[model samples]
Target: MSNYDITLPLTREVAAQLRAGDSVRLTGTLYSARDAAHKRLNELLDAGLPLPIPIENATIYYAGPTPAPEGYAVGAIGPTTSGRMDAYAPRLIALGLCGMIGKGERDALVVRAIRKHGAVYFGAIGGAGALLAEHVEDADIVAFPELGAEALRRLTVRDFPAVVVIDSTGMSLYESGRAEYLKSLK
Candidate 1:
């Protein structure tokens, strides 16, 4: 229920301080990667190959942004369904990925990994891509450019809005909020 203004490359301390249902305006650096990029990263991990981006204390956004128009930092950078990345998320979290930004429910395995690793999962507004793009100060494709929109990109965001849907302790706002609403109806 509290609000936070946090910067990225989230440390264990920062991750632990967050709680489910908290509002956040995240600033600083984060990476964009959809399911394809996540799969590639997992393959690299499995093969003992170097990853395209640093894994430690990193925050990955589940977004495949559109091509920016003239003078824009990004275009329609809305969150993709986080479940698409669920298969690969635990491995990344084990490698020190401390935060994620997307929409919808996460799988049980992903939630467990977040709790075990002192990480947090944030939810972005799904249909507010144009509004979200305004907060992105910079964006550059960093790897897998061949994948176009699915390519890994580095984004610098300022006051990017999100809500903490799952906190480090494994509290899930989605579950709790839904239960509360259902209870209210009864």
Candidate 2:
């Protein structure tokens, strides 16, 4: 029930605080990067080029936001499917990315990798654009602007609401919830 502001170079204590099904209101600087950006990041890693920003203890939000309307910093920012980045996530985790914020369930391989490296996956509300946008106070593209919505944006968020879908221990709220429901049905 306690709230936390996760900053870069996250400590083990902070990572441990995040757990599946726990509601969290994250604040501070978060990086936005989706499937396309992930692909490019991997390419950069393979080429041994410096990353635009260090991923050490950083939390990456998997979203391809729509263009913000006039006067808004961002618009319709919602969590995209997390499975698309499964193959590339282990690389990012190895690079020191501590956690990820996105929607839906990730695969077993991704879950194993997340635990293997010490990272958490948060699930923000899916299809709640206006609600989610309210949390994003400011947004600016830091790199790969050419990718448009898929570009990486540096966002300052306030009380950004999210639920932990996968904790550092590899626990999954979605799967447990489904099992509970199915047990009730039986």
Candidate 3:
């Protein structure tokens, strides 16, 4: 496993270098954004209004985490399903967003966009909320704080475990894994 402290807006070369099933520990700032937030973000972008947060070269985690208790930055933060963000992802990536972290698989369209935009997608443990929360050392709302859990939070994380789901070369582990398994039965 390699440790990466990469900032978002990753280049094609960077995306191509990542492979499915590769273990990586990411450290740096991450932002939490979910469906509602994505919709609002798109609206803001489309209207020529400044985005609440600068997404360029930034990594976003799709989640609606539990509220934090006093003195804690967050509570039981975990990745939500990646599919819900499909509509907004390509637009965000085109705006220079570098990576996405979520649970479950992304659709083919998202994979293509990631490859085209020099971005990567990572999968984190879906239901492991407690364990995931421990990794978020600091967090603050950079956008839409009124949305509560659905608000966008800027977080500083350490040793966040994830696997590359899609790489810059358009390689997808989820598809490959399924194909390999199906072929074995033939």
Candidate 4:
């Protein structure tokens, strides 16, 4: 696996060079959203309405962070299961979404969409919410405030770490790792 120091707004050229299992420290802007927001996004798409937030060539984190404590920009913000967004990912990818951050393996459809769209999927370390929150320098609700913690948030992050779970080539660290483990058991 390679290590990359990426400053976001991840472009297609940069995203295509990433490989599954590569580690990255991403610094810059990203939007935070979860299942509730994704569902709403799809609904807007179906009705031919423009998205509330600009998704083109953008990265999104699947999370619902808790309220900030004291001086923190954000609280314990951890990734939710990536599979939960599977139902909505293809549509977003088709709209030029480039990167996604969350935990767990994605469904087949989402994987295929990422490859076709030249996108990347990063796997944030799970169960490290508080530690992850330290990387977020700022967070502001961009849309859907009624969803509470699940509202779409624009975040400024520094040294935010993640692993490339699915690269633009459609390579998957989850599948490869599982295969290697099985081979080792033989």
Whole-model lDDT values for every prediction: 0.94, 0.85, 0.83, 0.94
Worst 10 residues of 1 by lDDT: 36-45
Instruction: State the weakest 10-residue window (summed lDDT) of model 3.
Output: 1-10
Which is superior by TM-score, 1 or 3?
Answer: 1
Instruction: Estimate the lDDT of model 3.
Output: 0.83
TM-score for each predicted model, relative to the true structure: 0.97, 0.91, 0.89, 0.96
lDDT of 4: 0.94
Residue 91 deviation, candidate 3, in Å?
Answer: 0.6
In model 2, the Cα lDDT at residue 27 comes to 83
Residue 45 lDDT, candidate 3, scale 0-100:
85
**TM-score for predicted model 3 compared with the true structure:** 0.89
- Cα lDDT for residue 23, candidate 4: 96
Candidate 3's displacement at residue 115, Å, is: 1.2
When summed lDDT is taken over every stretch of 10 residues in candidate 2, the lowest stretch is: 1-10
Q: Cα miss at 131, model 1 (Å)? A: 0.6
Residues 1-186 of candidate 4 have per-residue lDDT tens digits of 799999989999999999998999999999999999999998888899999877888999999999999999899998999899999999899998999999998998999999999999999999999999999999999889999999999999999999999999999999997898899999
lDDT, candidate 2, 1-186, per-residue tens: 345555544555687778777888788888999988999998998999988877887889999888999988899998998889898888888778887989887887788877988788999998997899999999999999999999999998888988888888999999876797899998
30 Cα displacement, candidate 3 (Å): 0.8
Taking every candidate in turn, the Cα RMSD to the unseen true structure, in Å, is 1.0, 2.0, 2.3, 1.2
